[model samples]
Target: MRVGIAGGGIAGLTLAWLLSESHEVVLLEERPRLGGNVKSVLTAADGGPCAIDLGVRETPVEVSPVWRHIAAAVGVSAGDLVATTASRVVLRKHERSPLWVSAADPTDTARPVTTGGPAYRAMARFADESARWETEGMSWDVTVGDVLDSWPLPSTAVRHLLCALPASLHGCTTDEVRSLSARAVGTTFTPPHTVPRTTYLRSGNSSLVHGLAAGARPARLLLGTGLRAVRRAGEGFELVDSAGAVHATDVVALALPADHALAALSGLAGAGAWRTALKAVEYREVTYVLHHDPYGMPENRRTWSAGNTTVDGNRSETTTWYGPSLGVDLFVSQLDHRAGRPREELARSSFRATLPTPQACRARQRLGAIHEGQRLLFLGHCTTPVETQEAAMASAVAVAQHLTPCGKRLRDYLEGG
Candidate 1:
């Protein structure tokens, strides 16, 4: 079969790499750059030229089996990965002492999340119980904030601690965390005790992107060609590019943001229900800025050798600590949804921030219904509605298993993810 994939991000690239062996694949990228949000750059530091990841800084091993498989398959070995010391701090406002934290992995650190006090304990109890339903198909009928409000929350400090992690991890504010569903909160966040030390590609995240493209050379590579529209064409599909060109294929997998995919499919007669379902989920824009100075850091200076930190409350945006996540000393800061532009912005790019609300879960169900029926499939952060490198790879693997001959084995290995 001839396959056409739109949006050359990790999802599209991974799908193409897996399917190219058995099918004729054509990967189309809307951007001039092939690796959607996974961009890497080289900059000068005290040690000379070093790789700085502007997007997707790392591929954490403990939670990312799919990521590790791809990294190894792409020739990125354990030796090439840089692990963090796992030390983290929660510098909340109006607090005398900083709440020290570390990744859940068995790592030695000065401070642990358990020391956050009563509120932290209450939040962890809720996380532990709610996270169990994660595998049992937890209902996404309500927002996470609604559930928290009903719970016996200890104090504002604990509330901030609980919400701060997911807010910072997924690029939303504490308030926005309330808008998301409990299912999403659990999937996006694994309490600090479960959090493992993330590993990064020595060269940068983009190395995996380049490696995938090299491993699977698509029949046609159309860069800077964005999809403008998609309509059913006879037994297959017809795609119209931003350049006014037309292409037809037997199968298509949209590896794009939820909004963009829905927009492209708006005119399709079969996509009426799909557009409605997709519209149910809300999307926010998040900006990641790469800079030299720690403009967003706490008044007290911190080193990159330490892990990333989260500022609680409305000020809940800061650097995810580029130094440790990518083995570089640069700082990559995340701004709250619709926050003012950064001042020391050396590089900036906007990516979609998916809200996993009750409505979103319904939308996801509807999307999955469509996925199960058609040759056209959706893959990416929005599909899983969990923004992480592991989520991206996991979604791709799921779609590949459905379309591949050895799907059973692929499913067996990635099902745990």
Candidate 2:
């Protein structure tokens, strides 16, 4: 079979890499290079050149499986690829005592979630009910206010967990999100460990992209070619590029973001609801200031901590660090918006206010989209299972599984029916 993949990010590359052994694969990329958000740069630092990851700075072993697979495929050990890990997290706001957090696998015990606060236990109870609603094939697609009003939540912490984490991931306030979709994705992952050390790709995240691309080496790997349209062409699919050039393929995976895929495959009517769902979902933006400071050192805390800061009613700022001697990189979560703001200005402000000023700081900002189409098979920093390389890898693996048809029913085989 011949497979054509759209978007040359980790998902496209990983799919191509895994399927190349059995199928003829052609990977299409709109960007000039692979690794969409995984791009890294090596620039001149104070006295010498240092590598800085503009995107995907961390890969935690505790939760990320995509990096592990990529590392294994490329002959890189996960342990060796890790840059730094610290034992403590010191916060600017909570200076009295640092919270002890660890990622060691906690014993799983099915316990009742907490509730009991001024906000009323009704909210927590409602959330639990909404979760049950999803198992029964119902959706909680309403404002956060509506969700809380409809359910019985009893605790502040539970309400905070329900409200904040989803807001951060979905890039929307509780009022604008789907309670069912949000909870479904949120409850799927393992929580962060106290000592949350990020693993840096020594050669940058793009190294994995290049390795996957090299492994696939598709017949016609076109860069800077955007798909403008997709219509039926006999038994297969016809794809029109942005320049009016048309290409045909036996199997087509609308692997771009939910919106892009919807626009390209507009002729297909089967995707109406899927397209609406994909478009309805929202995404958060990520911004960072990358620089090296000589003075105003950050304590050797493992992961940067966020104080009690709020962005549009969301606590986004996590931590600031002064130590890089042990290979620690500064990371910030949650931002206001992804437009009009000057990158250098934001970097300067973040540098001046947080850690000591570095000789030079580089600001990198990226915006991701979240949508609802099921046919598009969208995978990026904004989708299921967290915004990490592991999601991309898992998506690729899932794609492979989907491409293959099943034979006898598993239950029949086991029961000999």
Candidate 3:
């Protein structure tokens, strides 16, 4: 049978690679390049050659199975696909005050965001709520506020942590999201605060995508293309392209996000409830700054919330770090929409806000990249409130399973032989 896959992301590519061995597959991607948000930038210098992870930065031990399987299938070791290291976490509520916690002693128990505290318990509760939603078949329609209210926590710290997870993950406050959506994240992966960050990849982290692309069977990739529409063509389905071109296929795999898939299938035939489910889902915005620093920033600097500094009612969690040699990465959500203000100034100010007010502090800016456009089906470890690669992989599997029965076999193949 001929299979047409829309959106050649990790989900789409994984499906296509699995099916191509036994079927004819045509993988369509809307972007000029693949890899979606797993953006990696390779350094041009020689010798101590290294690559920094600009996005999808962390791969915890809890979620290594899928990524490990992908690496193996593509004929590379997990280490080959990542740069693993111990992460030093720093805490500071007010920017440039003092480093409350550091890797030198992350267990000092003085910081607010420290693990194994009220924050961790709240995370556990959130995870439990997410599991409940999934088992009850209510994961699709719930909100973050719903989950929080259901929790039995009375501590202010616990409440703050609960509120922070969804807002940080989705770039939106708890009230702005569905309770089920928030739960979906928890049920999907380990709550972020509890997961171990042991993985980093070289070649800018895009190597995995490139590996999958190369390892995939022939006639699998159809880049710079999108599914414009779908219709019945004889016994099979006719998939349309952006320019109204048509390709008939026996099986259709929409690896695209819920929104993109729903839009393309609006005029297509069959699958009413599925369409409704797809339409019910939504996405959020995220921004990050990837910089190359010859002089490393203080280890006391890391990720924190900026909800207190917003001009409007919105707030953001700004996460920053230096992993590979003088490299600083900042991930900030809930950015203000001010077209008149210069982006560089805002990023610099945000960066400065994350640092100590030392008069002698000197650090050079590297690269700042932003993805402000509407995102689709971003139900993964990175964007999801859950903090495990397992959640992201499971969400992908669930989405795939919803469309076809082939998902089981694909999942099995990814898990093992």
Candidate 4:
């Protein structure tokens, strides 16, 4: 079988790797490089040059078994997986003090407010209730705003915990976070009973991308080209690329973003439902700025945390990732149109993130209907409930299993058989 995978992101790369052993695979990427949202850069630091990740940085091993398993399967050594700590703080506009901070070591002088009085208590309550909502299977239509409004917590507490925090995480405005489905938020932010350790690729995510591509060795690797359209060709399909070249494949898998996938299939016959479902998944633009200044941090240095979220009026909330993990002074901030660019900015990149609004969530559920029993398949963020690296790889695993029989070794590792 010959398979043509579009969009050389994690999803498309992983799919090509999984099928390469048994089939002739061709991978196409619009960008010169792969890895999709997994981007890393080298920056000059005090000690030496350090690698700073601008996108898809860390993963919690407890929640991301697929990512952990695949990293090892691709020959990424254990030493390259570095365990790290994650601490977050929330601050109000122009305030030197943090409105809330996560619990930290008691002896750490930099920790602000050992106890977060009302806000901490409210957070506990919210976590408990959100977990219960998940256990009971909350409806897809229930918005986070709906749940937060029903709570008796103070408005400030609700705003900081539910609105600002998620806004920064999802790269959206507080108002936009409110319309997100409660189930989607709950699944992504389910407060664990115990703290979980997070890990990042010490060599940066680009290493993983290189490893997958090297191992896959696809029949044809086309970079700097994109899928223009998909058309029926006898019992297979003909993929027209932006360079006016045609590639025929027995199967087609779209690993591109929902909007891009829809546009690629615009010329295909009998694809109205597929186009509609893909179009229903909306996206918001997020800009990432890498700099040496504390653009989005709280005014106080003692209250600085690994992740700092600043909430101000009408402007979209911004989150700054402190550089202590990289042992550098660099910082990465997520900014929207309303925010100003960092003063000491070294580099900037922009991405279109899918908004997990109630409407978008419902649309995602219908995507499977369009792809089932069809030669064309949709994977990655367009199909997954949560936007995580693990989910993206899992989507590839599903497609690989559907298309071919899994070998015992790979099957045992993925399924714990």
TM-score of each: 0.87, 0.64, 0.68, 0.92
Q: Per-residue CA lDDT of candidate 3, range 86-117, in tens?
A: 33332224344322122222252443444455
Choose the strongest candidate by TM-score: 4
User: RMSD of candidate 1 to the true fold?
Assistant: 3.5
Give the clash count for each candidate: 2, 32, 13, 0
Query: What's the C-alpha lDDT at position 198 in model 4?
Result: 71
Task: For candidate 3, report its TM-score.
Answer: 0.68
Off by over 4 Å in 3: 44-49, 81-143, 150-158, 177-182, 187-195, 293-313, 324-417
Higher-scoring candidate on TM-score, 1 or 3: 1
Against the hidden true structure, what lDDT does model 4 obtain? 0.76
Q: Please give the lDDT score at residue 417 for candidate 1.
A: 39
**Predicted candidate 1 versus true structure: per-residue lDDT over 1-417, tens digit per residue:** 778789899888888877776778777788998888788777766687767776677655777878877767766777878875444566675554555454434653533345456755665676676778677877777677877888877677667766776676656678888887777777644454554466766777888888888877645768999888887888988888889988888887888877788888988887777788778867666677777776555554432224445564454655656655444457777755434454666777766667677787777766654344468887776576566777777777877876774743354445543
3 or 4, greater by TM-score: 4
**What is the Å distance of residue 306 in model 4 from its true position?**
0.9
Q: At residue 33, give the lDDT of candidate 3.
A: 76
- In Å, residue 123's CA in model 2 sits off its true spot by 16
Cα misplacement distance, residue 351 of candidate 4 (Å)? 1.1
